[model samples]
Target: MKNILTLSLVTLSLTACVNRDNQYDYIETPQPNQVADLQDDDTDGVINARDLCVATPDESEINNEGCGIIITSSNERHLHILFSNDSADIQPIFSSQIRQMVEFLELYPETSIEIQGYASKVGNEEYNLALSKRRAEAVDRRIESMGIAADRVTVVGYGETHLEYDGDDEMSHARNRKVTASVVGYQGDIKKEWTIFSRLPK
Candidate 1:
C-alpha cells in the first residue's frame, strides 16, 4: 500500500510538469500593428513621399501632381533682359538683375536655369537664329562668370518664336529681342513672393 501511494504522488507531479510545458509551448508573442503604422493621414493622394511637398493647404494652388505651384507673382525665377538691335551683349543696366540671379543660384546650389534667347523679325530666319544663339550664349557666359557652374546653365535660341508682342512697331521688335532666364528643377514649396531682383542705381 505505501509503495502504491508513493508511485501515485510521482505520477501526479510529472503530469503537472507536462501541463506547464504544454501551456508554454502554445503561448503567443505580441505582433506589431501594421494598420496603425501606415502613413498618409491626410489622404490627399500623396503618400509619405519625401520628394514632394506634402501637407499643402487646401486653398493653395497645387501643380505638378501636388509637388508645387507655378509662382506668378514675381518674375524672380523668370527674368527678361532686353537687348539692343543686333547685339548679344548684356547691357550694364541689367547687371544688377544678373547679380541678383547669381546670388539666388548661389543660395540654391541644386537649382538650374535655362537661358532662352530671342531675336526680332528684322533679320533673316537663319541669321536671327544664329543671333539668338549668340545672345543665349552671352547670358550663359555672364552667369558662369559670376562664379556659377557652367553645367547649371543651358542656352536655348528661339529666334522670332514665341514673340511677347506681335506688331509692326519698334516697341514690339524691342520686346521680341530679349533673353529670358527661367529656373528649372526647383524641388521646393511655392511661396507667395520670391526674391525680387534689385535694380542698380543710375
Candidate 2:
C-alpha cells in the first residue's frame, strides 16, 4: 500500500510538467522574462554600465574609460609682418598682428605655442641662428606684454634654414625673416549629461 501511494504521488508530479493531453503531445512552456537594455546614455561611445562619467560634455573627445577628454582642433593664422634685413627686432607697426596672436591664445587658454622664427641667408650662419631665435622671442615678448601668459610661448629659431623664399631678393628675404605659429582651439558646445535625480521632462 505504501509503494502504491508513492507511485501515485510521482505520477501526479510528472503529469503537472506535461500538457493536459499527455498522450505523447508537446510540453507546456513558461513565458520568458523580458531583457533589459544597456545603452550609451551620454553617447560617448561607452555603455552606461561601464561609464564612470555619465556627465560627459559634448562627447567630442572620449576614451574607452568613459570620461571626457580635451579635444585639440587645428587652426592657422597668417600675419603679414615684413622684418628689416639683419634685424631680430619686431617693429611697432606690427603690434596689431602680434595682438592677433595674443587673441588666438586668449581664445584657447589651454593651448601653448612654439613660435618659429626664421632668418635670411645674408648674415653669418652662427649669428643668424641666434638672430632667428631672438626674432621668435621678439614676438613672444609682444604677445606676453599683450596679456598672454609667458609660460604659453615657446621660442624656436631656424637660421637660414627652411626659408619661405630661398631667393636673395628684398621681398624674398623679408618673407624669410618672420615668425609663424599654429593654433589649436577647444571646439563645440559643451553639454552636460542629465543625472538621475537632476533630469526633468522635455
Report the C-alpha lDDT of model 2 over 1-202, residue by residue, as the tens digit.
9999999999988887777676556568989774643698887788887788887876245667788665445666655455788887788898888788778778778788888888888979999888888888888888888898888878888888888898878888888888787766665444344555565769
- TM-score of model number 2: 0.57
Once superposed on the true structure, which residue ranges of model 2 sit more than 4 Å away at CA? 1-75, 191-202
How many clashing pairs per prediction, in order? 0, 0
- Over 59-131, each residue of candidate 1 has an lDDT whose tens digit, in order, gives 4555545554645332346668999999999899988888888988886788889899999998798899999
Each prediction's TM-score against the native?
0.55, 0.57
lDDT per model, in order?
0.77, 0.77
- Model 1 compared with the native: what TM-score? 0.55
lDDT of 2: 0.77
